[model samples]
Target: MQRVLIRSIFKLSNQHATKPYLLQQHQQEARINSISCYYCVYSSKRGQQENDGWGKSKRHFISLLTLGIGLGGIGTAYILAKEVSALEKTATNNDTHENWHKERRTDLPTYKQEQITKHDTLEKRVWVTYGVGVYDITEFIPKHPGSDKIMLGAGSAIDPFWHIYQQHNNKEILTLLESYRIGNLDKADEVSTEDMGSPWGNEPKRHPLLKPASERPFNAEPPLSLLAENFLTPNEFFYVRNHLPVPVIDAEGYELDIEIEESDTTRSFTLEEIKKLPKVTVTAAVMCGGNRRSEMTEVKPVKGLSWSGGAVGNAKWSGAKLRDILLAMGVESDEKRHVIFEGCDLDPTSHPYGASIPLSKAMDERGDVILAYEMNGETINRDHGFPLRAIVPGTVGARNVKWLSRIIISDSESSSHWQQNDYKGFSPSTDWDTVDFTKSPAIQAMPVTSAICSPSQGEKVQIVNGCINVKGYAWSGGGRRIVRVDLTSDGGETWHVAELEQEDLPDGRHYGWSLWSAKLPVPSGCKQVEIWSKAVDSAYNTQPESFKYTWNLRGVLSNAYHRVKVEIE
Candidate 1:
């Protein structure tokens, strides 16, 4: 019986050898059960023991010796399991790039510029340089989001391209690029900064009041208080969301090319000719897809610019109606087709920034889509896409392509990097590693959102007659009107309706934002109070209560409840 019990214990330990922690627990339980069984058997047979003290003592000694052997076997199994687990963990760490710092190679080979140039083609294998590092990007070519755009840097340095596409300057992309590092560029062949002239050298001057989010591409927005002050945001105070350096366009020489994909025919329109067309005015709000992203980041870290609520502004845009232009050009609109807009803003490789909108929206009489040339009754400034820009009302700012250079009526959307890859939302769980941009559709109409413009996050408010006044803006995409704005001072325990000041426009045609203000009674004896505001659109869509539920990896469409904690005196 002792020999059988020892064999069973060894078998159980071997079965769970790979799971050290689990095996230890199971082994301990088995030992207790086996000892209990031995005691039961010994007690039952005790009456049958010989009537001699020496015989009983010998039997007890054997039982203890057997028990010791079982315990010894368990200890040995535990030690072996522990060693195996450690070895497995070491092997995993060796395979992952997380430990790259510990095992990074230092003896990389060096290659000259001429050598890199030789491997530019697929047949020769594509190679590119960044700074002093030479990388073999042959395998990454097919997987690149920009597709053939990456091939432009095949045999040369990609520093210029990366300078234009600053989004690639992130850690994830840099680390992924480093993984394909084959060698270092020879010191003598390194490109000088002088040779790579700044593309942003001719950038137009911007208003100091417009807070800068980025300098190179020149993204800026006005202060929230200043933004809420004007129903028609001043041309200079309007938010600027440029993705590329301002293009130096000659107003007299500027030409817009219109192409029909189905007919393979093209037509050109000069700035004067575009102005001669019937002019129309649109009062709308252009909000960046990443507006209020800073709030989302508080819930969980996300990619893209950390934009505040200021990345939005309402303006009166004047331009030639796109629908009328298309009809006059003898181009028939189809629901299945798309109106692709290309901007003159180009990267180092001359790839223009582009985006597309549904033909249905472009052709809709109420859509108000236009080829805008004037902002706030003044000639459009260079920073705001002077000469020509696409005014895509009720759509995300990304679709409103700036510096309009070309328009294409196509069955498919634009093949630009921004349209195909960027400005898309994803599940909070979908991180960079597992993100598949193709799976998610590009964001178009934005969600309902609102923010407190006055009495900023930590501002002190004077209670007038036991009530604190709150002011903010509320808006929704798809021409949805702000039906109601709700304010709560006691964490949504009670709600107060805010008076909405909106344009008197037809339902579903309310393209502008609704400025709302409310006076809430302060909780008795509360020194600090948090005020939360949310808006309901005409479509009955409302802002989410918490950012956690609406969080996305790219941080787009972050329209959660706006909360501000203020001190009451």
Candidate 2:
């Protein structure tokens, strides 16, 4: 069999040396894993090194089995293949084929349906990139979690581009794309030639079965493990907080119009130019101001997404400095007091939109503000932001606008109800009947906040004397690194300084959330362990227990100390 394999390899090599077989067409790379498949390690090269002829038979049999399992026949495969080819042709065409665009391509499977089938959707809801080139919407470019970086391969499949950089959006990426006009797209006659791997290959199979997202979760309560990691959250696990419907933009005609009040001037930066700036990246968390709104439901019915402390996410954001770009545009501040940003998502009000930050926060050093273009070393996810978005460290989440468009440098705050009427903390007694939006300022830098990320609040533990591991995350506002995390096992009486991971952990160690661990000596004869934790910000702002004093009609600034309980053996 081994000799036969060698002879067969030589024969195939001789035939290839004499006549060129149809070459595999390359597609734009949208993610890292795509690159691995392109450099196939299990191909004829390896087969030749082993069983030559017999190994070739074995491989052919496997390929046949795979194709059978993937699609019922070669015909369905060809139809799927043709659509991918058309998308590439559309991208490379030099003429305006906007008329050629006959349907909403996005509605089609994001990647080939076969790739989606590879994953066991019967269990978990992993991100399924099911199509050819990534959907590029130029108008929506600036509003991505990674901001303009999503437009990196504006006129081609993004699959090829994502493989080049482990950290791309972090650098100036104007040259990210060779060109942007899709009308001149080159024609491709086939779908990608890479073989699909196991759908459930990398994910863990032990966790409780995850129901389809469209179906309601088994429990609306937030999971404990989610809050432990502060950065680079797994794309699937990142908390989602959407205020309005996500907008889909057309990449070819997308334009960002900045109406400069002074000089009565309007300058436009195509999705391409915005990405050309010297790329920079910062690590921060975008936590909703009312992160724990569901907790407030106990006091009074709140009027917002019933979020259980899970509406925040942390990530390494890479893009241009919004301040640098504004300076280059010759934006004369004229003593501008604030810079208001408007996103595409809005409600039914006359101009229902989003909020803003002060000029100092918007354009300061510690602010580390960015017009983000990438997340987790890839272009922003469609759900997060596809084009442009703001990244403010330690600030409440409402200010991070997705689907970004306009930039207004003004002296006053945003007129959006979100800015003036919400996200402000007030006395616990304050309610709809007696509260005033003007009574408080827009919430900015978050107070020292910490949460128990394990051992669900009322979790039952095996009554062993083994150490009960206590884990959580800590953060402070205004670029203040989490200086310390104090864990009190006896409800604030006896305290232990927990161990914290300052850098990257094996899981989500750095770039987003700071992790803390406490090894409590499982006490003797204790039926329950009352756990409490607090953090001190750079400014030494500590969380006041209970939202009694931190409450507002809008339920903002709910940074109360997180407490949990567990039973002993």
Whole-model Cα lDDT of every candidate shown, in order: 0.70, 0.49
Model 2 Cα shift for residue 260 (angstroms)? 2.1
Q: Compose the digit string of candidate 1's lDDT tens values, residues 258-355.
A: 88888888888888998999999999999999899889999986655678899998988999999998888787767799999987665444456788
- Residue 466 Cα positional deviation in candidate 2, in Å, after optimal superposition: 5.4
Candidate 2, residues 1-569, lDDT tens digits: the string is 11111000111121112111111112221111112222112122211111111111111100000001111001000000111123333333433332222222332222322222222221222111212322223322322222222322222233222222212221112111211111211112112323332211222122232222111111122354766754456655666544433444434444555655545666666667778888888877777676666666566654444555665666788887887877776764434577787764322111224577877765564456787778867887645666777776667777787656666776688876567755677777754445565778888877667887877777876643556788887766656666678888776767777887664322211224567887766556778987788876546677777765566545566677777787765
* Candidate 2 residue spans exceeding 4 A from truth: 1-222, 229-231, 299-301, 332-336, 349-352, 463-466, 503-512
Taking all chains together, each candidate's TM-score versus the true structure is 0.77, 0.59
Indicate the residue-level lDDT of 462 in model 2.
64
Strongest candidate by lDDT: 1
* Model 1 regions more than 4 Å off: 1-108, 114-127, 135-144, 163-183
